[model samples]
Target: MKIEAHDKQIQDIFSLGYFQIPRFQRPYSWERDEVENFWNDIINDVSENYFIGSMVVYQERKPYFGIVDGQQRLTTITLMLSAIRNSFLRLGEDNLAKGVHKFVEQPNIDNEAEFILDADTSFPYLQDHIQSFNGLKIDCDVGIEEQKLKNAFEIICARLEDEVPTSNSESGGQISMFPVDVPDPILKLKEIRDKVLSLKLVFIQLDNKSDAHLIFETLNARGRDLRTSDLVKNLLLSKIKEGNAKLDSAKESWNSLIRKFDDASESEIIDSFLLHFWISEYNYTTDKKLFSAISKYVSEDEKNANDLLKKLNHAAAIYCKLIDPGAHEWSREETDVRESLKALRLFKVKQQSSMTLALLRAYYEKRLTLRNLKACLRKLEYFHFVFNAITSQRSSGVIATTYSSHAISLTGAKGNDDIQAIISSLFNSLRTKLPQYEEFEVKFLELSYLSSKTKNKGIIKYCLSKQFGDKFGGIDINHDAMSIEHIISESTMKDGLSSDVVGSIGNLLLVDEKTNSEELMNLTVSEKIKKLEGKGYPLAKALVGEKFPESSGVQDRARSIAQHLYNSVQL
Candidate 1:
């Protein structure tokens, strides 16, 4: 494999050859923010040269070069130049227009016009609309790639018109790219042209296609630019032997992982799922190093790529259940497990994936009983509440890690007793570090609500939901649908209560949004409580026809509710 590296300015680079985006490459999808950011970077420092990163290309059988990476940047740059050229032409700056147009397209040796970038299906839209922009057709229907390309073009034109003087008089006639005096439109265009031409990139060229693919994988793996899931997918697929069955099986497994989290976007699900899978296997914390960790794991036995794919497929199904248990239709034997999963979701306790994966594997092996799983989940919810909700801290105890390890150990257990023992040991160990009733009571009482702190309100709402569950017999209050209602309006400062005292957890209840807006505000504590009458939530029900003449009375009520919460969850 012969490798060559060189530097080329954008002007010379785009002028020399036509680049083709391969079918495997993702389409142009840069949004308005990204376009504005790029343009801002250019205009912010127009006097000096800037580096725009690197591009990987290989010589195809045809004369054009195939871009293996950096297609998004290259395509956006071409569209930007097209927009600039059309803007110049509209202003009747023919000399400036021609200079910008030359960088976007050129006549070939056969005298046929060729666009500098050929984006396959997006090529026609680019040629007719983007390259030679008249008025953007408002009713034109296009694919996502074409739409994004058009959006980018519009963004560039809009930004340029803002900076440079346009025919429109709505914007103040004072046109300035900088805080100082405004330059002539032609002069500003020339400055932009000169700056873009001075921009440099690392140019990599390869002769062999296979070698280019290897380089693409290596570059992506070493750089944080690529998604971890994409890198891992490429590694697994490339390592498998070239055959229809093996390739199809690997593809199917990857698709299954994607489809597992139907509610989440592809990138979000795959990246998070892979991170959880990594944690389960190694118990190592990571953010961007996931791809490197996965590569190291697969490098140990690359020939077993097919086996790795199969394991991932099975794990994906369990992962789906972890995210949304009620969505997955499990058997009657798994009903208790599903309920536990549902409770975990209601508590909004994510980041237990390691323990979740272990539980899932144990149930898959039929070693864990339904009752024990529910017991473990209930313990986990309480532990999470104490550590996360009340204390506002993560699970830092050594026993927390042991929960995952112990749960994994339960997968191969011999009987129901073994599974129960593991579950008991994990919870018992965690309970040793758990905050006692007194500690929780103090934190609960100290948990003051801030109208601005939405998360605090969410925690308080969950507490009310739990209280409701206890009193109303499976009333199924959707915590998300409920809003925080202050019995003593902080805005009104009812009963001379200060904002903090009025915002205390004791004065708060989760009421329906309609009741909160229509009846709660501008009311005295007694009147609001009367309005809360007949609400299913025990906290709301308790408040009805009650009077708190002083702030201390609200504190006393809050303390009682806190004590009940602590006693209910005691191991």
Candidate 2:
């Protein structure tokens, strides 16, 4: 573990290297808040030697280095410098612009202009939009990260109030920063460039990739500014030789893995999907230890890095399908599986994805039949409804461990018979893992809906729709085709009944909007029950008319409904 450290200003740091953010490094992810914070730091009263933070890099060649830490800061500073240069360029300060531009980008080996801080992910956009300030003919369909780069550059340009053309839309939406008249723009622009060049950072350089990998985890483990998934990717890709064609392939593979999750959110892509896939394929661990575990895992075997990426790509595709039911192509006959998977997502069953991923892969391999797969998924969904949704038990421990164990077992299943055996075991396990009918009855009895809590409302509707069992899929839960009709109305609360009993699960029934509206509003309990009996809808016949509970005796009726739900629940 050798290290060389120096305190360098932003200008000095950029001057020391032809830097490139590695393929594995995260894309520029600073949002308005971070960009705004950096802007404030630049304009705020500060010392000439004001410190930002440390940057960790490993040498690729004499003047080439790969950024391991502080990429966000470096990328941000580069964008700000480009903004300053744009201001100077627009103001006819050619020499001044060239002076500032030297820090933003320098001539590459072919004498072609190149960005000093080239990001592997956003190079074209960074070059065309921010660095080179080229025209809008270049087309790269913007993803989340690219959009952030555009936004950062946009914010900086607007703040600087440069007449620099912004490559916004095809028509190009360009405007000034403030509505008011500006005075003495050159002095303001020089001030910004000077502040940017003045900012100091601790430049920590390592002689080798191994040392950089070793230092990355320590720097990032506890930092609020860390992106752990990107760090994990760095550790995985470190061993691959730079300038090798395989490096490009590996980088593309990583990018493809990221692209599979295009529809998911940033947190979902970087945080949730990465963490969940690691749990499914490797050890069940927290985000805190995931980087370390992955680094060690990759270090242990030469082939592990490629193996892990393959697993991740497969799991990411599966994960997208798991979280969003419509993500995968389900055949007309496979609607049950899609519907049941959606039900699991609605129930907020996350850890079960560990098992579902394995189960789905087995089905994909033809090792498990669709029938058995559907059965296992339905049971998991139903059991989660009982154990997770209704009882609200801890989602971890026995249940999570059980799913993980079954997923592992499914992977090595010998044949169809073996896969079916695991499926049966999974089904029985889910059934037994459910809260005993008595326990469920107790919990279900305590259920009350509040107008403010959306989940509470959802649960009431869910219970009524599936009063007999898993009769409806997620479509029923999410649609507004029906509303809960209070058998004993909220009006009854004024007549001496309690609010809890009024919104209790026992007093609620799913009814069509018309049936639930003023048409049946003024009816007595018996009248409402009678009105529901003749309706030609599924939820209209949700509860047996006679079993409809009275306002005062809601507890007794809650007990009966609980008993029925407990026994009839399809797990």
Candidate 3:
């Protein structure tokens, strides 16, 4: 395939043939920023000549051009040409009149007389001038009319007559108005026209006689990474190896899908489908192994990948249905169920537990409704709690367990079996009772630390603040924006109390920021307690009386406060 730059006349030379785009090609609209930048480039190149690039046509027995890229440039050029043609008609340039007519009209034998008198012949020289003028006309704030086109054309003609430097000018003399430096807007546009005509873009032309599908696949696979949609297209095209009829059918099917989800971008659909394959189909035993598995699905399954294609198509349809209000009722239940299952699958992947799947299957077998499914979800939350606690303790050198033994450890009173049984029983009760509240409440309470003095109020306040913001006005406790403050400062721990006692959960309380700031680093616990008492805040008295009812003295009082805070935050 040969590549060469085309002149400004290339627009008139190559017929776009009704301007139909290929079905496989991505859509026309570029991102807003890209369009703005292109426009800016055109404006900047008004004086210097620019070449837009050559159209890479596949050389078959009959010549045909397939735009590899630069479609946006080509379309803009067409619009520019239309503007110029209109401008020429308004200007009464007798010699240029016939040239403009011919430029706009297709040559016909019967119209030879009209063609001779038309603006067609002079178009090659005058087209750029006319186009430049037309660009200025459009950019101006003047009202849109045929007169604007004529005025723009006249401006270009005048500029050409007055400013463009003559070739016959003295060799050493400095020309004030060279074509390169002309201030004329029409001249500037002509320069842009010249530059666009001269621009070069890389295009790989394949022999049209060769199998188009094979060529397309080779280009895609060897060039940029194939998107999921591109892969699906390749898979569909591969099935049409025998006849043109199959290829047509595949094209129709692809177009139908595009029409169905007209709003989704090519990239959005591709990435969403890829996520589906990764989460639902790929085996993720290890992170590296999982990626390798997904890669194989793309590279190896070349020919008989129709099943995968169908799955993607189904998912695309489902996604379209999800976003369409008209299809909402039909998809609501299934969509919710699918999302819930996805969440479960994610948990299983992260936890590396087959028990997650087992629980899901058990829920399904019991004909669990959404409520029952939610209960199962709650049980999984407990599993996460236990797993996280064990992992943290083990990592910190507080405890250790072998993998084989750990999986089995929840069974005996403190083993895997017992834990599973507890979860199973909880799920059964939830399903039977159709519990209105969250089933994880008990697990949360068990894992949560309680304040001995304030009772569950402190625990409830903490959880409520996390779930809903402080503005949720039902709680009687001062739910004003509060930070967790430690009674003992980590920096000044020279007292008998250990560092653990300073940072312990029991020593923490939700105090207002002003209160914390006022106490600062210098104030010791005893001093801070006195400040609170002076402020008429009952927190210190409450902690002493309710949190540590058994404590007899001040030392005991301080220890009890620390212990209560720790006990309140178990898991």
**Candidate 2: tens digits of C-alpha lDDT, residues 1-571:** 7789999998888887688776656677899999988887777847777798889899958778988899998888888888887666666666878899899778777897767888767757777777875447488778788899989988887876643332331222223442346544566667768888989989888987777766776777677756777677677677554556555766777778778777875654566777766676577777677777787888898888888887887777777887787778989778778877877877776778778888787787778788878878877777888887888888557777777777777876777777777777877877766777777877887778745434577766667666733344433343447787777877777788787888788777776687677578868887776665565344333554445546656777677667666666475
lDDT (10s digit) by residue, model 1, range 39-76? 89888974577888898888866568888777877887
Clash count per candidate: 0, 0, 38
Candidate with more favorable, higher lDDT: 2 or 3: 2
Number of the predicted model whose lDDT against the real structure is largest:
2
Runs in model 1 lying further than 4 Å from the true structure: 9-53, 60-69, 85-151, 162-200, 213-227, 240-270, 281-285, 309-350, 357-374, 394-400, 407-421, 450-455, 470-483, 486-494, 498-501, 511-553
On a 0 to 100 scale, what is the lDDT of residue 166 in model 3? 32
Alpha carbon deviation, residue 96, candidate 1 (Å): 10
Clash list (residue pairs), candidate 2: none
What Cα-based lDDT does every candidate model obtain? Answer: 0.70, 0.74, 0.41
Alpha-carbon deviation at 156 in model 2, angstroms:
3.2
lDDT of 1: 0.70
- Write down the RMSD of candidate 2 (Cα, Å): 4.9
> What C-alpha lDDT does candidate 3 achieve relative to the native structure?
0.41
**What lDDT does candidate 3 reach at residue 136?**
34
Model 3 Cα lDDT, one tens digit per residue, 57-139:
34443323444344444544443444444433333232343343343334444443211111221233323334332323223
TM-score of every model? 0.72, 0.85, 0.43
